[model samples]
Target chain A: MSNMPTESQHARGQTEPSHGAVRTHVISFAIMIVLTVVAFVMVGAGMAPWIVVPVILALAVIQVGLQLYDFMHLNQRGHSFPAFFITSGALLGLIFIVVLVLWP
Target chain B: MEAQPRLVNAADRMELGLETSTLEGRNKVLGFWVFLGGECALFASLFATYLTLRGQTLNGPTAKELFHLPLVGVATLFLLTSSLTGVLGINAMHQGRRRSLLRWLGVTVLLGLAFLAVQVVEFITYVGEGFGFSTSAFSSAFYALVGFHGGHVAFGVIWISILMLQLKKSGITARKAPKVFIASLYWHFVDVVWVFIFTVVYLMGIMGI
Candidate 1:
């Protein structure tokens, strides 16, 4: 517990974020908007369900990765436990949905 | 654990922002992550129920008939932008800029409110078209899943509003930082779920699948 500060200092380096940090966030926001717009446009154009469904689903997964890694800072050091918990929970939920929907 | 003697003031030791500067704060964050994990399973079950029963409309208005992509798309924009603002708020908190944090959080809360208002209007419009919760199994499941997510957004709006008042009062201390951080985490989780909701529920629903 006493050594926590030094560990955090080493991980985070500084209290103030650099210009690059802010830029990364802005770029991430841009990517999310692009992904969202693409998904909406594809669906709105009346594309085939077989293509639209899988493509939009894949896009959703990619956007979620951005949220988790960039927006939520799960990419930061010392997030292993947090990542573990969320990943396990998401996986468990996925399994639950698959099992229930497939066999019910 | 014995209380360690403070050689420096608590605020001065905040090199990693106030949230991770203390053992207690770190634990609070960790504990909240655990709670979010459980939330995932909880929402997943509701999603599973919706997926299975969505085809059982039984003469009621179906998903294709009920969902409007333009409206839902606008709502998604609101929430997604709010999430961006949320991360910016956390960034301000890390920079020790209290006013920036408050302003960003205020934007987040307002956007959340806007999303909820759209949802309310959508629900009301559905009911006007005889798509009430009791209309069919599909209607029930739809409301149960989407409404639950809306309920989370509403709760987040309220929670962040109160936290804003506290941040105004205390000006972002170690104690308050974790609260704000966890609240932002919750807000982000809600947005993540909505990503799925818009993809699985609205878009797919509009496709008549």
Candidate 2:
């Protein structure tokens, strides 16, 4: 029983966020905005259609990462359950989409 | 003394607010994230339906034809900015700055309203352009996927508004902090979904598959 991890370890004051961490959020928001604009420009520029699709998709994925990590603080500890469930949901959603769309 | 149940020192309170300090707050906060995960799956199914049905305009204006770049761009900007403001609201919550939190949450809700307003205009415009709900399979799918998201935004706006009112009426004590914090999290999740929608639906639609 002594070897087991204690819940009190995660209790108050243990996981308090540092004061300087807000900068990462500001930087993340800037990057997301820039990426979104780049995407809009890439499409509106009338470049090769299907070719640009991947670029925009990649950009969208990056913005999602920023949202999850920077803004939502999924980067912090104690977020494993939230991360696990959300990722599982995303994976399941992907499978459902592939099946539904690819089905004849 | 009103005999506060848990008296976290003021300095420590900012860092470890209601959400992380109390057992109920921590549990509910984690539980809410899991609940949102289930919601994500629900939206995923809708997205799949939309993906399959898109571009099958069937004598209607196609996506490349109907999606106005400027309007969607505006909507996207509004949503992303709302996400930023939500982060600010959380920062204020962590600082125990009640007035700043209220201001930020108010801005967040206003941005949400703006996003919804733009969406309503977009839908109305699309309908006027002969892309009404029953126009085609693509129309139905677009409305369903995007409207579901819009429905969520509407609900979040109402949720945060009520939370804001509560905070204003009752100052930032222990109990109200967690509710406000959780509502901001909900708002952020909505913004994340908007990011995907902007990319997959509007931008990709403009690309015409």
Candidate 3:
């Protein structure tokens, strides 16, 4: 309820993004591309469909986590709600789909 | 004469409407996130449909039979790069660098277009091989999942363009901040969905379907 914008507000304007954050974004992108290529190779290799599904899904989930946490700053103060909602929704979605897939 | 000067200033202030709007900014970000959540559900339904009819390829080319890893790999690279560029767009905006922001956004949009182009070609390749959407449950699921994602990317490109225009007109005031913020969130969400799409639609398809 202050009349003036505070130091925190000023800091937001002055603070520079860290090298680590930038590095993380770059590395994550590289990893996603590499994993995508690997997935393609695995699919091309004629491996059992079961094996490929899990590996590709695992990588995809990893990539999604990186995008949310690293790039989108979903971990920041105001964004916690969206982050929680999105993660919970994804989990619920997976459960719903799995149950349907496995149900007789 | 002095009173007349004050009157003109008041008129100018009225015309400019110096009070910045906050509702559009806040709602746009929150609303877009909500929309993305619904999108997750939408894709979930499509995935379910795909799983249910996974094996019915109608004597057409199945995932293992028709999916080309190299082509999918190329498309994935393009999309992944686009996501990175989207982040750069945000970074530019944060620094109040409009030109840099637009440049990065332009790169992201182009990459998205390229991804869509590749997808169209891929679909054509599949159809050329007699793997039409109606041929079997497998093809149906495949097309449904991929098509849903492709539609999203198309929408996102249009959306970002509008945002760019808004930013140009208004600059990055607090009102515009949320729009850019939400669009970035939407862009990342699109990327997240692609992660799953890559796995379930492309990678898994090649394994056996």
Candidate 4:
């Protein structure tokens, strides 16, 4: 086993002074707000329901993507496996919902 | 990174505790994910109920009449920003910045309170317009979806208040770190739920559902 701390260790690394993370997190928040506003407008404009639902869903998914990739730092080396597992589970759960609720 | 003496010191002290604890960081993470899985099941049941009872308005205002995009827009902002503040709090804890951690957590709780306050106002308004919990299927589903989320915000505020006290007594020691981490994960999960609420409850409601 390597003596060096892995990247997931780095994510959970306490006592480090990496305040730069705050800045990146703030940027992600700003983007999420902007996207949320856009979604609000698109849905409010009396757009076709079919078009609007998918658009808003896509935006919501992207915001979740941002949360995972940017703030959670799921792209870090050792974190990827857990991230993938979580994403797959969420996706499967979503599919189950659609199949059960909306499927013919 | 500048030589991380503080981290080295904390890690040194933490290695002993890490061995003794059954609920260390990784276990906490895995356990919380399992908890989230359970919550998913809960929401699925609610969603099924909502699908069944959505259109039974029983002479009450339907979702199209009751949902105001502008009001919901503000509420979503508050909840989403609170999630951001929780992220900041966790980042502060990771950096061992106790003051920033507490400050951000304070902001998070305050924003959560604001979201709940707005929800209360919305509920009051709707009820005044002849929509009560038992009024119709729409009212029931609306209350269930939105009130369930409101309950989460209430729980989050209480949870973070305890964390604030913990921060005061213990600072961001390794013991407190995992607690803060789990709290923020809960916050994020709440945020994710609101994302769906915004989409299905507000947006779809306004779409004449």
User: B27-99, model 4: which lDDT tens digit per residue?
Assistant: 5755675676567666656665676677789899998988888889899999889888888877766556789
Best by DockQ: 1
Restricting to chain A, the TM-score for each candidate equals 0.84, 0.82, 0.74, 0.74
Candidate 1: tens digits of C-alpha lDDT, residues B44-125: 9999999999999998998998899999999999999999999999999988899999999999999999999999999999
Considering the two chains of model 4, state its CAPRI-style docking category: acceptable
Local lDDT at B201 for model 1: 98
Task: Report how far residue B193 has shifted in candidate 4, in Å.
Answer: 0.7
2 or 3, which is superior by lDDT?
Answer: 2
| Top-TM-score structure, candidate number | 1
Q: Give me the displacement of residue B107 in model 1, in angstroms.
A: 0.6
List the candidate numbers ranked by TM-score, top first: 1, 2, 4, 3
lDDT of 3: 0.73
The best candidate by lDDT is 1
Alpha-carbon lDDT, every model? 0.89, 0.83, 0.73, 0.75
Q: What is the TM-score of chain B alone in each candidate?
A: 0.92, 0.91, 0.84, 0.88
- List, residue by residue over B1-209, the lDDT tens digit for candidate 3: 34664233333222111111233443466567677777777778788787777877777777778888778777877888889999877777766678888889889999999999999999998899898888887887788888988998999899898988987888877667677777777878888888787777767766665
Worst 10 residues of 3 chain A by lDDT: A1-10
Model 1: per-residue Cα lDDT over A1-104, one tens digit each: 77766545544534566547678888988998899999999989999999999999999999999998988888876677889999999999999999989987
Q: Which residue pairs of candidate 4 clash?
A: none
Order the candidates by DockQ, highest first — what do you get?
Answer: 1, 2, 4, 3
